[model samples]
Target: MANGRAGELVLRERRSLGGADWLYARLRQLFKNSIVILALAAVWEVAPRTGLVNVTFFPPLSEVAAAWWQLLLSGDLGDHAAASLSRSLGGFLLAIAVSIPLGLAIGWWKPVSEYLNPFLELMRNTAALAILPIFILLLGLGETSKVAIVFYACSFPLLLNTISGVKNVDPLLIKSARSMGLSSVGLFRKVILPASIPTIFVGIRQAGASSILVLVAAEMVGATSGLGYLIQYSQFSFLITEMYAGILTISVIGLIVNYVLVTLEQRLTAWKPSARE
Candidate 1:
């Protein structure tokens, strides 16, 4: 009996070790994947120092980092970064608030959808940047104009995704819901909206990207502070290092935001992926 118990303990220890080994293996894969970026950075550092590339127009990454440091030390970085983030996220959320119910209503009511489709198609296709002048005229080029552009930029994706999700709900599910005597609202809440989450999130991601792009454009137009404004001012003053630094900030911000959204998506939709697996 002692020998059997020892054998069982050994097996349990081996299983625990195996699980840890699996986790370490996955971490190693992630590290290996990052090597490409390290190689690129090394090449970037070397190419400029060697004078193989024109460093004046295309500043080295180090200069950009130094410029960023300068900006941070000057205490202006926080305000600008905050402004950009506020505008981007603010628009994204506003878009979500307005679009979801409207999209659902349109999708649920065939006549409403038909009537609105033409206008939505036109509005979605319209250039968000082009409306800058109009917004300036109406909202006076302050925070409101910039935020409005962001809102407009983000709105289409949310609306489209919500509508598609509602419309594409399975007919079989609807039939079953009807047979079970579920009310219309119950069918929608239980069957359609839940099913649409994945597609809706795709639109949300796309709109997020669009929101950032429009924010940059709006900032370029007339903003005292923001990442886009930094880029514009740097370019105007021929401060290539500062310009690239601004671009770097934008890139890092986008990556971080996308990562957060992706993480949230994965967590919220955990059941879908888990079920599929």
Candidate 2:
């Protein structure tokens, strides 16, 4: 009976040890995944305080966090954030609408591609910022101009990616669909689209990043309310902490937007192999 009791106790201890080991391994993986972010944050938190960087110009992370918290409480951040988001989403959605169909036509029709390629190349090469004055003159310093700028900035990547994706679709798949007596629209819908989705999402992700950048520039140049304007306002007033807070807010928003797009892409393309996996 004593021997049996000893065995039971040993088995319980082994189970407990196994649980602890599993938990430790999970924690280690989490740490490994987050190490770079943590390291950068630690440096940010320490550098200004240690005088390795000027504290006035570049406030410590803690001060920036405090400012962020204060802004959150004041409701200023939300208002500005919403305005910025509306502009970005408006322009991004518009770009998607314009690019997708046009890109498909360009990719599918030889005459369309021949007619549009030179114009696209010229517009794509022209810097959007360089034409800011022209946009201002044409559309004024209103929401229209900003949204147009964002649209122009985002459209090219998606258009180019979409064209490439459609063009590069496997001949075998196209021939198979044709063999099945599928209509042109049916072939495009069933085969070409599904194959091109992965590549199209790559452009979408790139456009997401570009939209944020263009929004910032637009807001900085001529806007009353936005995260970018907040940063500019804070900087001119010499509120370094608030400036950092605004910048951080933009970073967080951009990350969230990118994450959402990635999640959407993963869900939509579950059949495709994941680079992360």
lDDT per residue (tens digit) for residues 150-173 in model 1: 999899888999899888888998
Which consecutive 10 residues in model 1 have the weakest lDDT in total?
268-277
> Count of backbone clashes for each model?
0, 0
Model 2 poorest 10 in a row by lDDT = 1-10
Please give the CA lDDT of all the candidate structures. Answer: 0.85, 0.89
- Per-residue lDDT of candidate 2, residues 112-187 (tens digit): 9999999999999988788877888999988999899999999999999999999999999999999999999999
Using Cα atoms with residue i matched to residue i, what is each candidate's TM-score against the true structure? 0.89, 0.89
Model 1 regions lying over 4 Å from their true place: 1-20, 274-276
In candidate 2, how many Å is residue 270 off?
Answer: 1.5
